[model samples]
Target: MAGKTINPTRMELTRLKAKQKTALRGHKLLKDKRDGLMKQFMQEVRRTRQLRKRVEEGLAQANAAFTVASAVMSPEMLEQALMAPRLSTEVTVDQRNIMSIAVPVFHRAEQEAQPDLACYGFAQTSGELDDALQALNRVYSDLLELAQAEKTVQLLAQDIERTRRRVNALEYVVIPENQRNIRYITMKLEENERGNTTRLMKVKDMVLQDAHHYKS
Candidate 1:
């Protein structure tokens, strides 16, 4: 099946060789990119894990504090105290390219700064409410970071899979097929050259015989 559609000529051989060279180079580059992406993905996974643990712990503490506050305060008072928030945060999303993959970057684009998490008068809100709000505030940054890290890991993994497929195609399919075609073309060209040489020799021998007969 090799070189079935290819012309058995020097030109075709040269073209196949060039294509094979390019494929080999591309295969190497894709492999490198895959390796780099895998490394970045692992690092992001570790960071995400740590961020998740911290966020979970912070959330737990916040929940416990809220429970304690809820038990002591009347339902109406608790709802009224949290009616208005002092701090507001806005996140801006951008992208950064990693090995040709665009991964998300999150920034706190706009946020209102507050001296403390307390939005209500100290007289009305219990101390446990303050503790709960503080805990939620502390975890906010980590929660955003975890989101970014997890998203980056997902993008990297997808790119790595694509790169791996390309590498495999070039390594196991494209390059090998090109090599086989080149070999087939080369062999055919050599066989044609030998056949031409033999025919020329036969013609020469016939001419000599005719000259000898004419001389006799």
Candidate 2:
């Protein structure tokens, strides 16, 4: 007796072929998404680096301005000067979606300074007060932007990680299983075809022998 026989039905081969085709298409689509995600991640990394550099520069400037403003000006006058530069900050934050990730977008927070002559009433030059105020305000703005950029980059990094895992699963697990199943079904069908051919030949030979005996 045959150890085991596969069914010779055409349905098995047809189904296997269909599965293979579907797997191939899915594999290609996943690979494309992985590539696109990587590109977006790289771009965000570059922006993060540039923003960090800018923030450091702004901090240095603010520190220098504060030191000089304190040494050359009186506490009352300097306090007045600082208060004059007080800003009314209004932030309009929105989110930008890239590869299904929402990144923060800050529309240059609206800033307004209270103009008071009493704040500028000091022995220090107008240029010096103006310079210090500008430096301090720029530093504050830079810090805010850096925070947003850093947060955006961190979120994008996570997305890249998640996408990579999915890419690996499809490439290594799903498609390979489909291919293996298809191969097994194809071999089973071929084996069944050979066995059926052999049975047909044997039946024909037996019929011929019976006819010869009758003729005799």
Candidate 3:
């Protein structure tokens, strides 16, 4: 939109045309990248939704069983039963690339094969406690799956946002600006060419008039 900064010449027009071509190519590539990221992001979002629902339902069941157990058992007995944990889980953190974004992956490290939750004697503890422990164990893998899906969704969201911005920049700003510049340069070059041709024609007319007068 600003005034042209360079001299109006064929070379300048040529350079601007080349730049426009390159900008168009870059814009197309960015659009494709944005589309791909969107597809991946949508898939992750769906997976996260499903995993969250499953985890929530599992947690609710476990909590209800725990409440029943707490009410059924004597305070001292409940406290004693829960005083120690029977299972220890270790999680390993790593990263995997998705759509050029690094997403965290969590996996349980090597551990004793699914140990029993018999931290307290069954005679002292209510059956509700056993039910609650069983419910928790059943959902353990689902909880891990939910965590992985949520983290993946987060990373994909960030990547999609970044890609969208880039696409917008190329589509709305860079490519258009290059095109405008190219048009401006071409118009100026054509105007200058017409002016030079007019001046040359006027010079020829003057030369011809002078030669006719000398002959007379």
**By the lDDT metric, which is better: model 1 or model 3?**
1
- Candidate 2, 98-123: lDDT as tens digits: 87788898766555464532345455
| Superposed Cα deviation of residue 13, candidate 1 (Å) | 0.8
lDDT (C-alpha, whole model) for all candidates:
0.88, 0.71, 0.81
The regions of model 3 sitting more than 4 angstroms off are 1-7, 113-115, 212-216
Instruction: Please identify which of the two predictions, 1 or 2, would achieve the higher lDDT against the true structure.
Output: 1
Q: What's the count of clashing pairs in each model shown?
A: 0, 0, 0
Worst 10 residues of 3 by lDDT: 109-118
Candidate 1 off by > 4 Å: 113-115, 214-216
* Top candidate, metric lDDT: 1
Model 3: per-residue Cα lDDT over 1-216, one tens digit each: 424476556887788778778878887887887788888888988988988888889889999999999899888898899777777779888989886788888887535443566678888788889988888888888888888888888777787788788878878887777677777777877788899999999888889889886432
- 101-180 per-residue lDDT for model 1 (tens digits): 88888887435565656778889778999999989888888888889999998888888888899999998999999989
Q: Which 10-residue window of candidate 1 scores lowest in summed lDDT?
A: 108-117
Model 3: lDDT equals 0.81
**Alpha carbon deviation, residue 199, candidate 2 (Å):** 2.0
Better of 2 and 3 by lDDT: 3
